[model samples]
Target: MDKTTIICRCEEISYEEVEEVIEHGGRTFDDVKRLTRCGMGPCQAKICTGLVANIIHEHTALPLSEIPLQRMRMPLSPIKLEILATNSTAFSAVKSVLDEVEIEDGKVR
Candidate 1:
């Protein structure tokens, strides 16, 4: 596979980036996640976690079972802004929380 080939479309992570993380002491899924944010996107690792594991296995020659999978947190369902906006209760609830938080350049402040 091409180094620049995109592995995680949601986060725009490439195979090369993942390899670099491994080369730099990333031994597990979470390690790669912390170093490169590979699976922390809208899809939440649903797509790329397997691919990442495969890469790790290929590079380290580790058994597939030995590579730890990324943990899935709560809020499995994606709450869309448009859907929330259409519902007053949901919108208000989200808006109230958002009011207290500051988001700049896609990062929460």
Candidate 2:
């Protein structure tokens, strides 16, 4: 793939950036995400997961099954803070995420 080819469109990440991350010992999608913010866009990894997986496979010889999937969260669309503040039952999916958080020192991890 061309280095300038857009991989994660939402974040405007390019193939070169992704390849650089892999070359620097980034082995997983999350690793690339932390380094380049590849899959954390508005569409999340939904659009770039397979493309990134392919890149990893080509570079590292890792099998598709062996590649770890991106950690997806609930609530695909943006929600207002007021909705969360309301504590209403509508955003239960978001609530589930809050419930699953690992907190330490009164901070979310």
Candidate 3:
């Protein structure tokens, strides 16, 4: 593959950048991501995840099965903290839940 070829258009990540991360002790997809920001784009890795995985496999010779899946996070959209704090209904709902879930000795009580 061309070193200049763009793998993640959203983040402007290239094949060479991914390989660089791998050469610098990036053995997993998450490692490459944290190092190169390859999969942390607007698309949320929907496009470049497979490509990154392939690169990792090619560089490290690790089996595809050993490659850990990317962590699935909640709130796909960026939430505005100001809006969440100012919204009385949402705040009250979260506060009520927290109030009920009492923590004792690092366990919910």
Whole-model Cα lDDT of every candidate shown, in order: 0.84, 0.87, 0.81
Candidate 2 lDDT by residue in tens digits, 1-109: 7789999999999999999999999888999999999988788788899999999999999999999988766566656678665867656654466688899999888
Query: Could you say which candidate leads in TM-score?
Result: 2
How good is model 2 by TM-score? 0.78
TM-score of structure candidate 3: 0.71
User: On residues 2-96, what C-alpha lDDT tens digit does candidate 1 reach at each position?
Assistant: 89999888889999999999999888999988888888888888999889999999999999899987866544657775765674665454435
Give per-residue CA lDDT, model 3, range 14-105, as digits (tens): 99999998889887778878887887877888888888888889888999898888865543545666876774666665543346678999
- List TM-scores for all candidates, in order: 0.71, 0.78, 0.71
As a whole number from 0 to 100, the lDDT of residue 76 in candidate 2 is: 62
Models sorted by lDDT, best on top: 2, 1, 3
What is the lDDT for 103 in model 2? 94
Model 2 misplaced regions, further than 4 Å = 87-109
Candidate that would win on lDDT:
2
Show where candidate 1 strays beyond 4 Å: 80-109
lDDT of 2 at 79: 62
